[model samples]
Target: MAFVPAPGYQPTYNPTLPYYKPIPGGLRVGMSVYIQGVANEHMKRFFVNFVVGQGPGADVAFHFNPRFDGWDKVVFNSQQDGKWGNEEKKRSMPFRKGAAFELVIMVLPEHYKVVVNGDPFYEFGHRIPVQLVTHLQVDGDLTLQSINFIGGQPAPSPGPMPNPGYPGPGKHNQQPCNLPCMEGAPTFNPPVPYKARLQGGLVARRTIVIKGYVPPSGKSLVINFKVGSSGDVALHINPRLTEGIVVRNSYLNGKWGAEERKSSFNPFAPGQFFDLSIRCGLDRFKVYANGQHLFDFSHRLSNFQGVDTLEIQGDVTLSYVQI
Candidate 1:
């Protein structure tokens, strides 16, 4: 099937062979891309390029090529002003011929963090700020399934942002939960209508980050922070895109509660990316999208103990649920 990208998004060519993608605004901190596909059964090599322009011989910020033609290693390098740099070789290949793979590339301030099939793979030090790279090129012995990019300059901080703890719990009454290290943060990939136990349940200042794309055919997306056992939704962030509004409500003992549908702006759009965050405050749940404070849903349920499980369902493709 042909690949259909979102409006203003780059499209892939010859899905089974090679393709070049244009990064409209380029890559920067907070930007991550997910690539899902397979290596050819008799694959020899494949390359994914981060380049500055669409023209030939343009500077390449980073070049990632994995070879399996007997010389089994991944080569990484960079080109600037037309001069090629020394090649850095990584001596591991986690890919199998003809096997499917899920790769995530996260652009940080210093380097490009790569995760292959959900595990730490390699870190390619940035030869240049990746944000300046304007195009992404993929080619060689691979069958491209899908290439997706998400994230952008976060919504300007609504106010002072809260800095949370890492790989551990947070203290009470913290304003925000800005994690210092992305690698140390816990991540989850639950099934749709997903529900998972939040270790030690909820604590003040604890936070959750959900990243995903709004489906092109999306109607609305709903996220509920509630007691896993009793199914009481404490903060139900229901963005009813069809109505051009977000409806925040709760469910108690299986009955829907009064809705909190007021918002300063509608932060969602079909075929866009959203980084929805919810942080536990002393008396209420603080919600933010892209970084802008959306609103709050005060404590409602009798037992806040069940803030242990997070449930999300709707027309969205979740990249992860990081707590």
Candidate 2:
């Protein structure tokens, strides 16, 4: 995986407009992204909608409309009423039980590809003209925690070309480097397949601060270490999953499992960093490319909660993992 470093967009939480706005002009017609939030009755009013052409309000709202009498009668809504017919796909926001749900959506030339809880939820084909999509909407009552764009600049945009002190990849910036931190510090304690333990390595953290890289790149950086039957590598960070960083995994073998969720990548590459950070949400995992997001597994698995510890095997290194 080759990570192209660039400025990213900071999450803007405006209750009045709803939805977090990504970097201006950063959104494309065929781009995909992940939106983390909770769903419930109040969510019926709140939706991930889009607006274009200097509209007075939202151009259209794409809520969970069950009784939508359209081609796809499942997740579409046309009744305009906040309430729509329900389906198995329709779920109570993950935040209700204090759990967070992540949504993966794509911007097609014509529709919005929507995936909920790491699964393909639905595809909205009502073409909102890429130029018209000046803003992304999140209405209803659910709290908007984080909005992560899959692939783009490494750092959030400097806002209208003002350009902050942010530099591109390869630039040397003062980061968390040369410390006592070891790869897979004491944050890992989960059991692996066939009774293998995830805490059987050197048990020390190697602190390597990746300078000049805001949302670290998926390529260029690699965390090499040893592996076991469980063969899982984790990048432990704060306790919340709302952190604004995405990890891209390319080289790997066997199945990949993190804290709350688990998934598969490809053949192992001896040493590689594939898991992204979920702020305080320990074990929140995803595959990345460049500084973009690819796939999101589960939220928090019981076996790996409070997993502020990151354990890696098979030639791994701990670089720029937020403490």
Candidate 3:
């Protein structure tokens, strides 16, 4: 969403070889470039397409490439809506063949955060559920400058140490605890935990979901998660909103429990990201914001832990996440 132009980061117009940085978390990727040594016939035909596959043999695939109209264009094929949508034109700028553009793509539960040239660009949803994306191809004239996967090291930096106040594992027997964690915008002072982040690359729940930043106010702890059809979840603090489930007697449960004590947040805007913390255990959940108490609730008769699917209906950016 934001831009940082450094002094030595010059553009590489027609880089001859492919340059790559591998991604961690056992994720695999492939890279290839079709060199149109003769530029005329392939001038307009030049295109780069990356095939995102769950595994080596999976048939379901996601495709992405710069738009065919010309250079400096970025586009993707969405499998959920079954269409090829063009991203905002300004998302990709000053495109050139063989230029050193790196896509730091992390595939989350429901969407993919795709960062191009050290910045975030788009969040493609209804994502391909496979663990690996192993194909990259440049359709024309472009040179495959270099290829490498950002493997081994943990890409994102570790969050600040959990403070003594953090409840140990699922220990919620007592109430009102603190957590030793980082608050505020992520900094690159010591190499941003992950690579550069992009805007609109994160997906958050649009409806029945509230969005906001967590400033270090008074409380400590933030809980964010998706509850399943039969589960109950709740946020306890100054203010929060509930979606899908409801608040019953003492907790938030499924089956459209309660519509009272609703919290309001500005609808998610484009190109903005927020960090949240959440803890899930047994049949109960609690949410906090920026070290403050928003609210808390519990669920009954809901087997939600097994439902791992989460989808972000709108664009939101995420610097890092802890499972």
Which ten contiguous residues of candidate 1 have the minimum total lDDT?
164-173
Worst 10 residues of 3 by lDDT: 1-10
Clashes of each: 2, 55, 44
Report the C-alpha lDDT of model 1 over 81-137, residue by residue, as the tens digit: 889899999888988898766677878788888877667888898987765676788
TM-score winner between candidates 2 and 3: 2
TM-score attained by model 1: 0.52
lDDT of 2 by residue, 182-206 (tens): 2321222122110223333322222
Off by over 4 Å in 1: 1-17, 154-309, 312-319
* Ranked candidates, highest TM-score first: 1, 2, 3
Tens digit of lDDT per residue, candidate 3, span 293-321?
33444543254333332332212233233
> Which one is best on TM-score?
1
Which is the winner by lDDT between candidate 1 and candidate 3? 1
Off by over 4 Å in 2: 1-17, 20-23, 40-44, 53-58, 61-99, 152-323
What would the TM-scores of all predictions be?
0.52, 0.39, 0.30
Give the lDDT of residue 45 in candidate 3: 34
